[model samples]
Target: MKALDIRVMWFQRALHLWLLVWLLSALPAAEWLWEHPVSPELGDPGIVSGLLHGFGVWMPSGAAVPVAIALLLFAVIGAFKSRPWWIGALTWLFFCALTDRAWLANNGGTWLMRNALFWSIFLRVDPSKEHGPLSLVPIQVLRLQLLLAYAITGLQKLHGTTWTDGTALGIIASDPTYGPSLLPVTPGLCWAVLLFQLTFPLAVWWGPTRIVWLAAGVVFHLGTAFWLGIVDMAFAFLVFYLLWFPEEGVAWMMRSLRITSTANTT
Candidate 1:
């Protein structure tokens, strides 16, 4: 029962930040549609658009920009407010936008962001109140979901000759579309990433290694983003790291900040 009194501020802030980044990163796509107009390849939103259209909601050809802007504002306000319902509503709307056939521009990371937002709706937003871990079920579910993603990806990689031989990164680095011109992807680095992903869940469960594993995760994801030119996807992955961030750590950080501020005021 003692462990149930978890504080949610860290998760809230992380969700807010992720939403902001996701919205901001989406701006360029929105801008492109605003300038080019909707077409099958450029702006075919997705399944959500089809469903909505069936219901008589005709999403205009060039509405992506305004929709993204509104979601961006929602995220900005969420950073300072405790309106979980508003966040949830806006997130659902954004998901609908993402599903538009003309807006077929998403990846695994984007899906992760959407699921995280869906779960965050159930998190308590008031920092002053203590909530049960049971009430924080969404956070736990997200952690499991992320771990499963890592495990499944690692297991899948194991079946690949390139990953086993450590030539997988080299292969990716050679890809013309997503490859980095400057950064070199070596066998050692590829193996390190594979091992890290395979062991991440266990490391987090071990307590002492959780912070180290998370730090390493940040480095790995950032490196991937740099090499793949998928910065937004990296941001989405990093946002979930907050789930493992401990309540004690956040409380201590808040106390230290408060003490520093008070000393400066004196």
Candidate 2:
């Protein structure tokens, strides 16, 4: 048997858990399937109808919740061990279709989730096995996706007055809807956020700077969660950070653990 890349295995496990959390969080929304089906007028009437209208064997609303829950359960199991890669991917694809059928609730985050889930399956399905070279492709794609998100968000801030004026964080914080209002939102903090986002992609690729930024990223997301009350989104982004963590660091960690175990056994 080939020696598995322990680093990739752990990364895959993180993704599995990330998917589980998002899927479980969506469970409450299943009621939507019964309450409102997709509109026939949106998208193509035939395609939309085709999604909902089906033989007794299958239909969007009829199967959406059940499939989602199954996928969620599978993710939970996959988090602990290997799962059938094709089935897991197909389930996520179907889930995306169901969400599209309920297009009103779809947002950029949902699209990102769909993309992430699709790419995640291409990683190691069997946690026990070492990852093959092909698995790296999906991980790289995931890394690119997250970096693009950060870069785009930061670049967009350049277009807006509040972000540039140093009033953006303060404005959002002051609002009852989104904030840790009592916490200070200084201009310096705002500038730091801007610069961090703009350069994160580049900075993270280098060995020495990667860990510092990765740690900072965790703190950044925690702050965002506090300010925006978007705990799920923040957590999701943080999970993606695992993709950028250095393989050498992981290998060193594993080696340390092995050494400690050997010492204990002596």
Most lDDT-accurate candidate: 2
lDDT of each: 0.66, 0.68
Model 1, 198-245: lDDT tens digits are 998788886579888988989988987887888877877787777676
Question: TM-scores for all candidates?
Answer: 0.79, 0.80
Q: Which portions of model 1 miss their true places by more than 4 Å?
A: 1-7, 31-63, 127-130, 181-184, 259-266
lDDT of 2 at 244: 72
- TM-score of candidate 1 against the unseen true structure: 0.79
Scored by lDDT, model 2 comes in at 0.68
Q: Write the per-residue lDDT of candidate 2 for residues 126-215, one digit (tens) a residue.
A: 433444567668867887998999999999999888888899988888887875586788998889999999999899888788888888
